[model samples]
Target: MLDWLTSAALHAFGAPTTWAELLGFASGLLCVYLVVRQHIANWPIGIANNLLLMVAFWHVGLFGDAWLQVVYVGLGAYGWWRWGTGRVEQRVRSTTRAEWWWLAIAGVLLTVALWWYLDRWTESTVPGPDALTTAVSLLATYGQTRRLVESWWLWIAVDVVYVPLYGYKDLWLTALLYLVFLALCVLGLRAWREQLRTAPQGSPAWSMD
Candidate 1:
């Protein structure tokens, strides 16, 4: 696998060899940074990261992840528009705890659907886990695009599984990226909670009835 990640194989990344990966690497970092700041700019940066990663994953033959980037592209664009057009201020809803029943139902449905589709239809060797992670990630991204604070917890859940999955696939750098994402989720959660606390009395960030 080391051979697979060597400077030679990555010559497509250009003279620095790691340029493409670094573009992906840095954009991932920036996306997390912007999200932590609660800046709407995170969406564009997130879109950039997704596009870069789509290239990276396709090269590595992680087609599932490559397809996921496509979804992120669409979601990121929507998030950018929604946030930038003052729609966020108009619709900035407070986070509520997801009900235990709904959480259970979603979990079971996602797991089963991923397992069934991947195991039965895809040529992917790791399809079951890959599909499961992708499904949860889709849900998390959907929540994040809407600025739902609970999205971080969903990310946390997926990251825990994804780190091991990437490691198993010998994607050390990608695994490292997910590790940073996990930490950022924790930071983002704390930051957003504080924002909730300090929001104006009638602001949407506040949980007014």
Candidate 2:
């Protein structure tokens, strides 16, 4: 089974797709799907997906993304704790206008900072774009943990950037996965909007200072 899973027959766009990539792809997809449905299970499954992709990205010398995956592990744990209450459906909340402003500010700053770090400290080729997406993804993950509908919007932006980035690395399978992620982000946004209409409504105003 292991050999079959890793066989060259599992190829995409003329590139071999390893069993690990396939596992990460499926796990990542499922996690996003669950997130869209407002399920708490996405956290653990996303961790699994991130771990698998961490190995894949590191092997390809995308150290920024590899490290991002490791960071995602702890973040996912925090998200799990934040969103996975006994009455989980009740705890889900949306981001406020003020939070969006702060998140955007931080996203830009972190992107610039990470770009500089990756360019100077690492061997990353697409440092600018990689840093941008990675930074936004961090904020997006936090937004999703808080059940913010705008998280899906941020994910849409990140997926658009990630597809070509992965393709440039010849990770065609992962690139295609991001395309699916783009679609899912749209659906998640719509679903979460409807959810906000009925689930629970509260201000997400928290100090960013």
Candidate 3:
């Protein structure tokens, strides 16, 4: 079983693809689709995708990205809990300019720091770009838990960069998957904005809790 799993991750790294990649890919697409539909199930699906892709990235020596998937598992759980226990304060809301400024500062610091670390400590061929996306994605995941509409914008930006980054790494299917994510972000952005229109200003949008 272990050997089979190892081989799956090593298979082409998306030259054509493998069951591991396909599993991750499909779950990723479902997660995005659920996000569009405002379904809380996205988080669990995202966790599965993260685990599957972790192996896939590890086989290709994208250590930073590989470890990133592990981090995402934690983030996914937090997201699931937050959404499941939907509170009034967690409803779709606009971020203040002050919040945006702080987020920008932090995100930049994380990206630069991770870029330097990956460049020095890892054998990754594209550490700079990888770090950029990973940092942005972390913040984006946080934003989702906060129910911030701007998270979709961050995801849009990440997908744009990730497509070429994964493609250059020879993960062709993942690159294409990123394109799908890009489009889904567009859909999610619109859907969430519409939800914000109906969301009670100071009340939980749904009583999922």
Q: Which predicted model would earn the best TM-score?
A: 3
Ranking by TM-score: 3, 2, 1
What are the models' TM-scores? 0.79, 0.87, 0.90
Q: Over the stretch 1-209, how does candidate 1's per-residue lDDT look in tens digits?
A: 43333333343212323444556778898888787776777888898888777776666556677788999999889877776675665333455556435655686797687667767766667877777787788878877777777778889999999888866765566677889989999998888768666776546442211
Question: Which lDDT tens digits does candidate 2 get at residues 1-209?
Answer: 54544444387888887776778898989998887776778889999999888877876778888899988999999878866543233534578889988998999899999999999999999899889988988999888767677788889989999999999998889998999999999998887777667654553322112
- lDDT tens string, model 3, 1-209? 43464454444553656566767888999988887776788889999999988987887777878888999999999888878876425567788899899889989999899889889998988888889888889889888878789999999999999898888877777888899999999999998898899876665554332
Model with the higher lDDT, candidate 1 or 2: 2
Question: Clashing pairs in model 3?
Answer: none
Which regions of candidate 3 deviate over 4 angstroms? 8-16, 87-90, 202-209
Q: By TM-score, how accurate is candidate 1?
A: 0.79
Winning model by lDDT: 3
Residue 23 in candidate 1 has what lDDT? 69
Candidate 3 TM-score, true structure as reference? 0.90
